[model samples]
Target: MVKERNKSFIFYFFVALTFMMTSLFPSSGYAAESNILDLEAKSAILVDAKTGLILYEKDAETALPTASMTKMMSEYLVLEAINNGKISWDQETGISEYVYKISQNRSLSNVPLRSDYQYNVKELYESMAIYSANGSTIALAELIAGSETNFVKMMNEKAAELGLENYKFVNSTGLNNQDLYGNHPDGTGAEEENLMSAKDTAKLAFHLLNDYPEVLDTASIPKSVFRDGTDDRTEMPNWNWMLPTLSFAYEGVDGLKTGTTDLAGYCFTGTAEKNGVRLITVVMKTNNYQERFGNTKKLLDYGFSNYEMQEIVPEGFQVKEQETLPVVKGKDKEVEIESTNAISILMKRGEKELYQPVVTIDEKLLTTEGALTAPVEKGTKVGTLTIEYTGENTLKFLTEKGDDLIKSDVVTTSNIEKSNWFVLFMQAIGGFFADIWTNAADGIKGLF
Candidate 1:
């Protein structure tokens, strides 16, 4: 009997251990493993174009070589100059010796500029935008700042102004200074490449798209002829393969930039819109050209699939327990307060309940016990209602200065006037009599 009991005990112990191991380490067919969306890139980020809300990130803050992606900053400054009337689309600018020599290097992305010929701003911009032409980018830099050196200063300054935190702009074209053959911009080493974090790169792209949306018109062109009907005509094909006209066409994809170098691998800043929701994504240092777009698709797909623009709080929404504020010396005793606008945010699907509305009244405007003064007009601003997220994942935006919470103005729903003097006096008398009656009743109860 003892031997039999020992055998059963050992058998049960092994069975329990096997069960524990299986529970801790599931097989490849586990359902939970299917939910993970991983990217094959060094660093990546996804953002909502409308709200600047970061939806996903992986090592996004680490600064890395950005290669030709630096041209997005150049594109921004060029558009800014045009908007400020400092430059014009028809303005003709002659190429410098440095630009002309770079243009002749067919090995690099260029549109062979003639030393004696001047090109209009529009064509040069198209070449740079569509073909990622290094020479055209340099020419535009010189045209804007009189030299690449001054342009580099402007890039850094604009990066700061745009709230880009981790970045260093060494050159405009995103090329290694050594690629410029000793004629690179001043104050930068020959081997140094422009560096920017994936987060900052997304911020720069966000600002570029927001400030100068017209850039999309040029950036979306699939193919264009540089200097058409002229001797310098060159077929410029967009490097962004995700465009609808490209081999790896993705719906709603358009108007961004791509970068490649030995150090930077293949990087891309891509944007797309579907069903009125737009997403911006950046993938840096992918192994190959195809992999960059592949990883971008993964990020975009995951964002669109898992999240959506949800109107969590409707317009004129009132916070619970904060629906009204007492009004002193007013026609009415209290006034209703509500949100000025609807609160909409990109939220994970099925997680709307995780967000709660928080109302903060202007303390100075409030009297004792959160009462407002009389003569409050309809639509008068009272306080702000901000949405607070209560979920596991921490929310972040493209810029540090960006407000993480979605806020709307809290305002009075109706007008309230001061009570007439006669009405006030009558109320005071009524209150005095009521107090005497309450004291008398209390004494009678004590006697009983």
Candidate 2:
């Protein structure tokens, strides 16, 4: 009886295990993976600037106010102005009444420079970036364009230039209406909405790093003592906590921007590089501070750990060495296409050999003077070298002919016309042989 009971229990155990496996595992027809499988944010994106690949994104098109991050463009415009020689870093800016009002409000980040005091352009940018001070941004705006209105105009024009289709800037400072006094009297959101999307923000950040990298020099400072014209000591600590904690702790955490407001939650644009792989991650509208950092860490860790930047087309790889490609109407039966720079790819571990490069060129359909005249230029639209895996997954890369390809001006050996008189003598000899053969054939037919 005990043996029968044990057998029954074993049968039940097998049935239960099978049920769990079937319920837990994904079925064949169901989706096993998606770009954004798990994320909790209004918007987010992960992009590799070097490769210009969008690894993952969600709600990238939704435009929303980006709060203090608007200062990124303000910083962009300021750098452009400085590059154009409109203003120098040492130039002093008077603390106007508008700055005084914004400073006294305390609702905005301010270092409290006296209205009569004068601070240089350098000091104001420090406060604007480190403390997210509203007053310093206004002063810099006025200094750059003679007034905040003109500066905002320049900001929009730069935005247009940057191809920010879903962005608009109302003020250089990202201070919201709730932080200001009067019915739009403080000029907060007085113009249009200071809005942006995740993709646009990433693009802006990428350009800022590539175009004006000095901003990172300022943004990366964990703590800076700003000595304005006044004696009041306002120490501006970097709002980006990761700057200190991750600068040394995390592998490649570099300088970037952060923003927050009642309406727009904590937003951050962070950049990091490891093993020659650099990427930008943007997280916007997180409910809390921990989630912002946590989500960023999760995304970044996934990027760094899961994906590796692999070179598919290594430098000095002879394009012709891969396979003997056929060429028609040419002295040499094959032409070589080589990679100029090593083509890099981001892929999962153990997948480095998953790609095999293939080259494509135009059809050998045209010829000039018994020589091929293929319309191929340096870096021109040749053919693509695509890497394919076992399945349908594939990535295409461009393979170009080496820059030193011989010109089409080379003389063809099989010329139909000869320049020398010896060419005519040979043609007459060949005609005599042809006539002798024809006469012999005609005499044989008459005899027959």
Best by lDDT: 1
Stretches > 4 Å off in candidate 2: 1-37, 178-193, 228-230, 246-249, 320-335, 353-371, 374-448
* lDDT scores of the candidates, listed in order: 0.88, 0.67
- State every prediction's TM-score relative to the real structure: 0.88, 0.73
**What's the residue-level lDDT of 186 in candidate 1?**
88
- Each model's total of backbone clashes: 0, 0
Superposing every Cα of model 1 onto the true structure, what RMSD results?
A: 6.4
Residue-level lDDT of model 1, residues 1-448, one tens digit each, is: 9999999999999999998655433332211222245678899888888778887778888999998899999999999999999999999999899999998999888899998988899989999999999999999999999999999999999999999889999999988888998997889998999999998999999999988988889888888888778887789899998998798789998869999989999999999989889899999999997899999998888778767799978998998889999998898999999998887988777778888899999999988677998989999999999877777655677765456447889999999998999988988899899999999999999998
